[model samples]
Target: MKLLDSGFRRNDNKLFFLTFYDIASPKTGGNMAGKKKGRKISGKKAGLSPGSLVYVGSRTDEPVRISIMDYDADRIDEIPEATLDDIKKCMARDSVTWVNVSGIHDTAIVEAVGRLYHLHPLALEDIVNTRHRAKLDDYENHLFLVLKMVIQEPETIRIVFEHVCLVIGPDYLISFQEREGDVFGPVRERLRKTKGRIRKSGPDYLGYALMDMIVDHYYEVLDQLGEEIEAIQEEALSNPTAKMRRAIHDARRQVVVLRKTIWPLREIVAGLLRGESKLFQDGTMIFLQDVYDHVVQVIDTVETYRDLLTGAMETYMSSVSNKMNETMKVLTIMATLFIPLTFLAGVYGMNFKYMPELEWRYAYPSFWGIVLVVFLAMLLWFKNKNWL
Candidate 1:
């Protein structure tokens, strides 16, 4: 784990978005910082004191990038790596301001952002700890939200997971993402074009837009898993193997993870709707209700996939058991057919000098005839009983 001691440097990739009262905005190119290897998010913060500002994510040499978007209804200005004064100025504006920070690996910059916004220390702690679950917190001045963004990686259908935290203030919005990606393309495009109500709405609407993008991506991720579950189910029906069981387990695990991510978000949204948070307006609540409904739909889909995977696993086990039983039955029938034949051979092999049957000239031939008849009769009986 990298200690928070090397000083903070902004990464190359920074996303800045701002929406003002005038609403017109222009797009600016922002570089995405490359990924780097680091320690596990959960274990990195172990043995540390409470409220420690240690970053608990993979170590990335890429400096934390901060992009600021200052916009109003008339026009929008884009700034990459804006100084502290710029952020404060944007916050003071009556128009909505969105400051997006791409990397949270640097504690100093995160702490600086927190201090500028007067965010609680615990909220900063949660922001640094990537393993934290989806939650919502109200600190009078602003609303803090944590949620998971699950996206499928390209080329391979593997699920890529990241934790995002959003802090919603009176007229400013801040988003912290673990890494750089185009997951927010739709929202960014909306910001650039100013086509929809996102530009016409307040900061709460912008926060909702960001969260909505994250939630919308869940369906795409779930769709991929759904396809996998179908493939595994087909394999289980046709030619089942140990691999199908493993696939079922893996699919179920993914569903479980998605379920965990989506379930909490439902509660968070519902709580916000029910709780008196002045940050959210009546119009925003309507949008939030829609988000909650979407969450329910995603959760339902995940649970359905989970059940299907379980059924596929059960079918595979039953198929293997039936195959084994049929094999044993065939072997048992063969042994039973040999029982009478073995008895006859054993009686004839008894070397008795006074045995009349053994002395008969045609005894060997007659014995063979009897053995043949017995064999045919037993086979006929087996066939009649439908046991063959």
Candidate 2:
């Protein structure tokens, strides 16, 4: 697996490039392999205590890119690859600031941003740990959210599941992502064009916009997965092979992983709908409700894929079984047709003096005639029975 490219950009500008981690391309036509050192498969920090600042993600030389956008109805100021001082200045502003952190491989930068924003230790911990569960934390001052931002692998029917952590504060929206592609590009485009109410709304709406972009993209992924499932189903019914079987299993596994990562997000958004955090303004509740609805749709599509994979697997098994049955039926017919021939041969093969058939003049030809007749009779019977 490898990430060819990913980052936040405006005006067609290249925001950042990931040089260290590239788990975007799956070698085996499925999700990223668990053994890939780039994804920080769990158990790396077994003895480390909670809130440890170690970055439990890919060891990437790609610098942590921070793009800050401070916007209001009056004006908007965008900073590309903002430094610590710039981030400090952004936090001091009264405008709705969106600080997009592209890579979290450097715990130092993440720690600095957390300290500047006064984020909770646990939130900071979750930011660097890619394996953290999808969850939400309301710490009175701000709301921390951990969720998966799914992106599709190009030219392949697979998904790139990247962990995104966010601290939705009253004045700012800070997003932390593993070294992966940009899923929040649309949000930046919206803010840049001032196309929607995002500019007029507060950071709550910005957070909603971010989540909406991610949730809406789920449909695109689902569409691709649906096509893959259909193709697998057709192949399973027609030309089922071991490769097709593995594909169905891989598809099912991807669906299960998707469900596990996305199910908690529904709860997280529902928590916002219930007004669990004060950071979410009343106006934001409707948007959150819409997001919740999209999440439900995504989950439903995932379940449908799961069912399709299950049916395809059964269909493949049934195909193989029918094929085996046909083979065995032919073999059984051949063996049955040869039984009498074998008996006749055995009688003639014996050297007993009382063997009358061996002494007959037409016995050899007669034996062949009987054998041919028995073979044709069995074939005709099998054809009549529709078992041939």
Candidate 3:
């Protein structure tokens, strides 16, 4: 049950490191433990109201980090960390403002941001509950998007699942994450350089960029998984041990979880493409469509991996069975060769008063000679029959 490796990249400040549980790693309490954690999280809100703000995830004491990027065609302001006053000033500007919250374990941070943006209480509730699935909810004034961002280590194939929520308004977009590091670094760089149409676009287009970055990273994860699947398949065909079978099953379960986590984003993206919310502009629908295509490709890759795992399991079982059959065939041939020898010895072993062969001078040597001849004859017959 030793884990593959830790895939997360720790920050230099070392404020806090996020813990990512893999469905494939047994040492990290695979699917059953995930279920128990889910139940425990649900119990925390058993008696609470629907809109009650409760952090339903791993508890941490680290302070939440808030960063902002306010940009228009001409100028862009980047704040590594912003205070509420700074956020207020950014809100006053007539530009696309992006507020990124690094952690959501604190209900107060979410509550404060909710109040500033006039977000629905239910939306705030979903934001704090980190286990929510990928979805889209429209609240007339803005759109709420929940997504699971998958991060995989290139060398170890270790995967981390992070919860991402986006609340897109007319001129601003607020994003909430469970931890500090993200794939959004590229999107932030693009914003800083004023690259492409992102600088001239609205919040909807920026939202698309963030989601697109996440979806594109899925290819990297899938590539790692693809190599792992090939390795497992080779091991199953060659070794076919008990441990290999477990690896195959664990891999299949991982693929299932990946499929479930990513499948919903397709509908969410398609909803945006169909103009389900006014927050998404018509100019951004084409880009959203591209994101939708990426989601489909990710889904297809996941499906293909699932099938490959199934075939690996079958191959493992077949290899094991064929091995057993060979062992049983050799044992049967050995027993068949001994049958005549045993009968001859039994006949001579009878307590006869005067047995001709028992009294012979060379009886024992001749008996061994006959036994060797019979053994060689049977072996030759078996070889000819191709059962050897």
Cα error, candidate 2, residue 226 (Å): 1.3
Candidate 1 stretches greater than 4 Å from native: 1-34, 41-50, 351-368
**lDDT pick, better of 1 and 2:** 2
Candidate 1, residue 221: CA error in Å?
1.4
What's the lDDT for all of these models?
A: 0.75, 0.76, 0.79
Candidate 3 residue runs with Cα over 4 Å from true position: 1-42, 154-157
Per residue, candidate 3 scores C-alpha lDDT tens digits across 1-388 of: 1122222222342211112352121112111111111211456788888899988775555578899999999899999889888899999999999999978888898899999999999999999887788899999999999998877543333576767899999999999987666778778878887556999999999999999988987897778677667877887888888877767777776777779888999989988887867888888998888899899999999999999989999999999999999889889888898999999889888999988998899999999999899989988998999888
Arrange candidates by TM-score, descending: 3, 2, 1
Cα error, residue 224 of model 3, in Å, equals 0.8
Work out the TM-score per prediction. Answer: 0.85, 0.86, 0.89
Per-residue accuracy of model 2 over 1-388 as CA lDDT, tens digit each: 3442221111232111112122333332232222233534457678888888777656556666888899998789999868989988876777889888878878888889999988888889888877678998998899999887776655443456677888898899999877535567667777898746889888899888888887876787678667667777777898777766767766676677778877998999988999867788898898789899999989999998888888899999999899889889889988887887799788778888887887899998998998788879877987998977
**lDDT for model 1, on a 0 to 1 scale?**
0.75
Per-residue C-alpha lDDT of model 1 across residues 203-235, encoded as one tens digit per residue: 899988888888898888677566666767777
Q: If both were scored by lDDT, which would come out higher, candidate 1 or candidate 3?
A: 3
